[model samples]
Target: MARQETQCVIHHSKLTSYCNVCGEFVCNLCKQSKYGKHEGHHYMTVTEKTNELKEEISEYQKMITDKSLKPLRENIHEHYLVKSRLDSNCDELTSEVEKREKHFIKEIQRASQKLKNIINGHRLEFSPGLASRIAQLEDKKREIDSLMKTCENVINTGNTYEILEFSKTKKSDLNTTHSSPRQVPKLELHTPRSGSLVGDSFGNIRKSRAIFTDEIKVLKSWSYDMYIENMFTRNDCVWISKTGFFVSVKPKTAEEVERKLCPVHPSGFIVTTSGEIIYSVSNEHCIYKITPALTVRLKHSYPYLPCGLCLAINGGFYVTMHKHGADGKIVHYFNEECADWLEIMCYRKGVSLLKKPIKIVENGNRDLWVVDAASESVIAMNSAGKFKFEYTGSRTCFEPIGICTDSRYNVLISDFGHKMIDILLQDGRFLTSIKLQPLGISRPMGLCVTKDGHLCVGQGNGCVHVLRY
Candidate 1:
């Protein structure tokens, strides 16, 4: 069977050649036509073009294998190796924990039994004799009491003769002396020296320290015309909340791919694990969640104005809020269903936990890091709402606004006043600082740690800087 040639729609002619300049298959008439679109374009036979493309594809295959696939495969293999080692180390730790648990249980049981035996010995040695002595003393006391009462009644009601007779009869009994008071023996059991779960006596777990350097590498930067108040990364893209809307932009191309306008500007926003945007408007009393399809829904209504938002490790979230014209800034924890579960109000002695919390983030260890701009510090608390530590910058003019935590659980705070990102250990110890001024990152406010460990910083000057930490 013979193959039919392709016909050109414009001229109804058989297509026999390809135009390199126009990048289209052309008929002989197309090139020969004086007034045609491809009149002066270079032409080549279809077979020749096919052969050229085959050669180019062969080169591309080699380039891909050497430059891309090979390196990716090696990296994947390294990840698997690391994962295997991690699993083995975790198993050993678990076994060690179990062994320690068994040893502690046995020791506790032995100590309890010893104390019980001492108590039983004390009871056997002193109980019966003490009971008998008490009974005999009680009988003697009753006899003396009755005699005195009879003597008093005769003196009060009878005549002098009755009083004298009563006195003479009671004199011998009254002269009898009682035994001196004796101290009772007491059984004192000392509590055994106990160890704490978090104390060094029991053992402790330490996190892997994040390796850092003073060199700040800016992997990508995007500039916008609108002011970026808050931004969070979702995969390769980031959703930035501007004045009255949220825009999703690709940092690589600096392209605004999607935009959703809001009635009010958000005080803070966060991208959840499920690709939902949870934000709070400071003037409003409710938190809102925007689904992936940009459908907005009310998440929760609270008594105070909600602001900073963060997702918890247990599929919950934290929202920092405060009453209008009030100083008692508090935080609320909500479940995955957006139902309020816990409210952190004050510390010991009714001390305020946060003065002006502008942002919040949860680290890998479930510690909540809140940026208290009014306090000029980053307050940290455990997952159970116990205050951990407050990290006020070592500098005098510290003004922290944005906060996020890295994989190592180290808290990262963007200091707008210092124009730098301060890194601290989970215990609130200042580890280091990344000066963003040198890298052209001014007024760094909103922060999000990308999945690949890059730090996405949204600055006040309409710039988003992605740093490789």
Candidate 2:
């Protein structure tokens, strides 16, 4: 057979140059050269174009394989991270749940033990009456034990259905029946005023003793020449001497007067151990320090309203405020220059101010005793405002207006409406009510127990009455 003649055919419609080595088209003589169109070209017939394309696609199969693997690797890594986070969260939740379960189980066991003790005590006291009830109680106890077991099983299995069934059964068995009547034992008793124990030590008793009676003594009443004007009672006012008193008038003015103290409105007053009179004027919003020679010396101001005043053991005084809903604050003035004093903001740690704190007095133990007039209670706290105890006033008609403490640590509370002075122990126990002999005390406002145990009370009648115990 003769060799077929190879011809070059140009397919211009396809926009492709053909090599003629395999009987395809050649546009120019340069196409025949090995370095030109013939270089690395696999010549093919015109009908083999589709087969050549199929061969070219085989080379790109590996690239497609690599592209498909990228998403699968990324998805696997993301799944691993998510599963790790989920496992950590589940472990934390399981730990918390186990701790809570242990605590609740301990609490329930303690409650069960207490109930058993109570039942045993009842059986010992009334064996005949409790014998029948003890059998029923045992059955209840067994039921509770079974329910607890079910709850434990449910917790271990984490089964909501089992927990719900246990809860329903417990509610039906434990809550449907009425418990037996129990006799509550008495704790304390009181004696009558006949100096005899009237009942068994479990009844309320009235004792023939006085609360603030020891602090009531008569003082020498010497009428001064000064007419009684409007006196502003503050916590810091002090009697400088027998004739001179000092008080603060305003933020800028402090006055010390002889023969008579000026009528400056004050919220509280106190006498220093050295006989200096210091007064806190709430309306003026200032604390004034006065001398014996009728001279104004030191004055200090505060941002809040001032009410109760008491001198601390360190010569610095504490002033309680009347600001409603506000925590009581105490400002301490240490030095004579008024520059070194420290104001402590102690609202959370101390005796909280109730409605309106009216008076404050320091006891021998250095504890601060405050009288809340609005709440009608006497509250006791340490120097730093730590709550100690409280004495509630008489509920029927007693209103504690003025308060003072004696050297013997007795608290004297003056009631304006009842016109009687209630004596209370340092622990807030009621001692006795001292009825005024001269009866017409319209409103008793101020009170002070003298060194000789005389109760000097300031009445609304423009006169201070001295009461003897």
Candidate 3:
């Protein structure tokens, strides 16, 4: 090991000068020695060389401040402004809701008071009439008692004629009858029907309309000679598959870190949650798994040619395959142990489910998404193999090649024919399209979402485009 202080190995002296020709430090003895390597080489004093290098370093510092630091500072300021405006908007919305709530409460109280007044007026109008009717009935009962006393006195005189005379006199009184008592007024209350508060009477929050675009800004890109068939992202590195090779490249410098040779199918491969590389060979009808240590071994063999593969979040995996010589195609789900679990072939008795299922992926909801090239559509099915929906692009010539799902379960499909990527919901509804032609990406094929939520797109022109979508 060498010390921090530079020393000349041959001269056994402290280095004090810089050798320009050899680009190394040298001592005074080494420079002036007759048998020295720097005898004829250009040399300068240590102090002079330090001053000259300081000037160059000053220029580098200026470049860094102007080109990198300036933009970063501006971005920070812009973000601060955005955050301030967002906070202000939130406060304003809350104040508006509070005002509306106050108004609603006032209106309810006013309506209740008005209804109470009407009920009180009805009670006041009926009370007097009811009392007067009771008084008249009591007076009539006293008159009947007086007549009965006069009749009893005549009967006590032991005269049948007097009794008959009393009956005749009371005949008119007996026929008389008090009118029927007035019924208490019925109070039938009416109120508004109960329902959701989001209506004309009560305000509601409206969803912000999405601003669609046909272009996606490219963050960075790397050029290559071989066609990149697929991309799998793990952490900061991206693994791409070409004809007969699987290469892992660091995005920072676009430098190749590792390469493995495998003539994988165009649908390429997938990296499991456990960091295992799973790929398929169409001609051999086989699937291979590679560990993180670069050990490759045969994992499974299929009855038909296996094309595309994907892993589920629940420890299962899925694969799409085509019949050996028939037009029939199918998708198979394998359990956590890599054993066949379910086979999905036809949607019904006569209707087929898939035509040419190529790339496959499982979304956050456990729904399987398959890119069917022959049908020119992306197919979605539930975990139980039930058909969900098929999404054919708006364009007539929809040539979908790459398929991936984002953290939000938004399905992204790369179309080679239109040179665009379609963003869809997990339910197969199209949300928007990202045009790649404008970004100089002609053949957008392989797609993957990085761990940091960035999108990596592989093109047919042997270049991969990294986007911050």
Give RMSD (Å) of candidate 2 vs. truth.
31.3
Residue-wise C-alpha lDDT for candidate 3, range 1-469, written one tens digit per residue: 2754567777778878999999988898877758577787888888899899999999999999999999999999999999999999999988977897787666656656665675566554447777787687679767767866775455333244565677787777667753333564556654433222223233222111123343347788987777776788877789888666677887656888877766544445776666567887777777777775664545445557778888766555777887644443544444434544445554745677677677888899888888876778888877545688888887988888988889999999998998888888777766677877888889988899887777889888889988878
Cα error of candidate 3 at position 211, Å: 2.7
TM-score between candidate 2 and the true structure: 0.46
TM-score of 1: 0.53
Ordered list by lDDT, greatest first: 3, 1, 2
Off by over 4 Å in 2: 1-206, 210-263, 292-299, 335-351, 437-440
Better of 2 and 3 by lDDT: 3
RMSD values for the candidates in order, in angstroms, are 20.7, 31.3, 26.7
Give the per-residue lDDT digits (tens) of candidate 1, residues 233-304: 777777887766788877666688877766677887777777667778766677777775665556545557
How good is model 3 by TM-score? Answer: 0.54
Of candidates 2 and 1, the better by lDDT: 1
TM-score of every candidate relative to the true structure: 0.53, 0.46, 0.54
Which residue pairs clash in candidate 3? none
Q: Give the CA lDDT, 0 to 100, for residue 104 in model 1.
A: 60
